[model samples]
Target: MSLPKSNLQKIIQVSCAIIVSEDRKILVTQRSASMSLPLKWEFPGGKIEKEESPEQTIVREIKEELNIEISMSNKLPSVTHHYENFSIILIPFICKIEHGEIKLSEHQAFRWLNPNKLLDLDWAEADIPVAQYYLQTLNK
Candidate 1:
């Protein structure tokens, strides 16, 4: 059941990476079956820790989760989404890989999809708006 306003859970602050290649492909990862969202697709990232800026969160999370170092090129405004059990403020970053190769430790799969094709995959609830916002930015 969704949280009642009086008993709301803390809003988790998360940082996500929209890793773009020189050729304009964007990297996305599928949540492992054991993950909360199961096999849904999303831009890779994790929770922001204490004392971390959203940019710092992206770099650290990418290294730990995707095994790569990244440099942020731009940041989208944070999007807050409420799921049945919790809520999140998802901060999205537009970035490019600076080093290392990917060796997924937590995801079930990944894909480098062209921007226009992002909507083709089933996305996590929290990611739907971020993806839509990104696509809107592209058309402008």
Candidate 2:
């Protein structure tokens, strides 16, 4: 029998920001053509660097990638997915923009989408479960 994904020897830890607006829309970004998983849409955040907590990573990444500061509101359930060559555990947090206008620097495109319509885009595999969980939370 194969090992459970959690038992994988090299699982990567990634942080995700679910930037929600007062109107219930969430920010989403599409990967640049030169990035891995090119063209797949994902939430704005990045890999957790050494010595940085998931929270710190999101704050720093959002500023660097979108030029905005955000306040974390809640922690969503984390999702783990196995790709062809690796696996990742995505830790998601609900966030609100604290200041500054967004100016995308790493993504090819971005959108403010109603939560219900998020699945309409082609999402990176790791984000699929996180999006589903976020949507389910809205129904409860």
Candidate 3:
């Protein structure tokens, strides 16, 4: 089934980060119990605000959500996903932590896991492709 015209026109663009640590682990955050899609693991990120570039969105979101600074390294393929009530264009970028300890304000938990182990968690649907791409291209 397809969405109605009104709903189809309401796609949200989100900027997501695939943060890699010095030890080669990828960072993942769990949604807080009160948040939409609660407790699902996902790459930490947020919706892009008006007039903001995806890169800027990621930088700002990481600071606000994780309380850490990141330097974007590369842009990954973007994924668009549809749900019952909405759709999202997930733009992912590779980033490295530049400063500060992570202090989660919106997430319930966080983990640094090997790329190969990313699928072990119960991931949010929109982030599955991002994880798969990382695993497939890790050595490239």
* Residue pairs in candidate 1 whose N, alpha carbon or C atoms collide under 3 angstroms: none
| CA-only RMSD, every prediction | 2.8, 3.0, 2.3
lDDT of candidates 1 onward, in order: 0.93, 0.94, 0.94
**Counting only residues 3 or more apart in sequence or on different chains, how many pairs clash (N, Cα, C under 3 Å) in candidate 3?**
0
* Model 1 TM-score relative to the real fold: 0.94
TM-score winner between candidates 1 and 2: 1
Q: Which is the better candidate, 2 or 3, if ranked by TM-score?
A: 3
Q: Kindly list the per-residue Cα lDDT of model 2 for residues 59-107, writing each as its tens digit.
A: 9999999999999989998888888778899999999999999999999
Candidate 1 Cα errors over 4 Å, as ranges: 1-6
lDDT per residue as tens, model 1, 29-130: 999999998999999999999999888888999999999999988899889998877899999999999999999999999999999999999999899899
What shift in Å separates residue 100 of candidate 3 from its native position after superposition? 0.3
TM-score of 2: 0.92
- Regions of model 3 farther than 4 Å from truth: 1-9
Clashing pairs in 2: none
Q: C-alpha displacement of 90 in model 3, angstroms?
A: 0.3
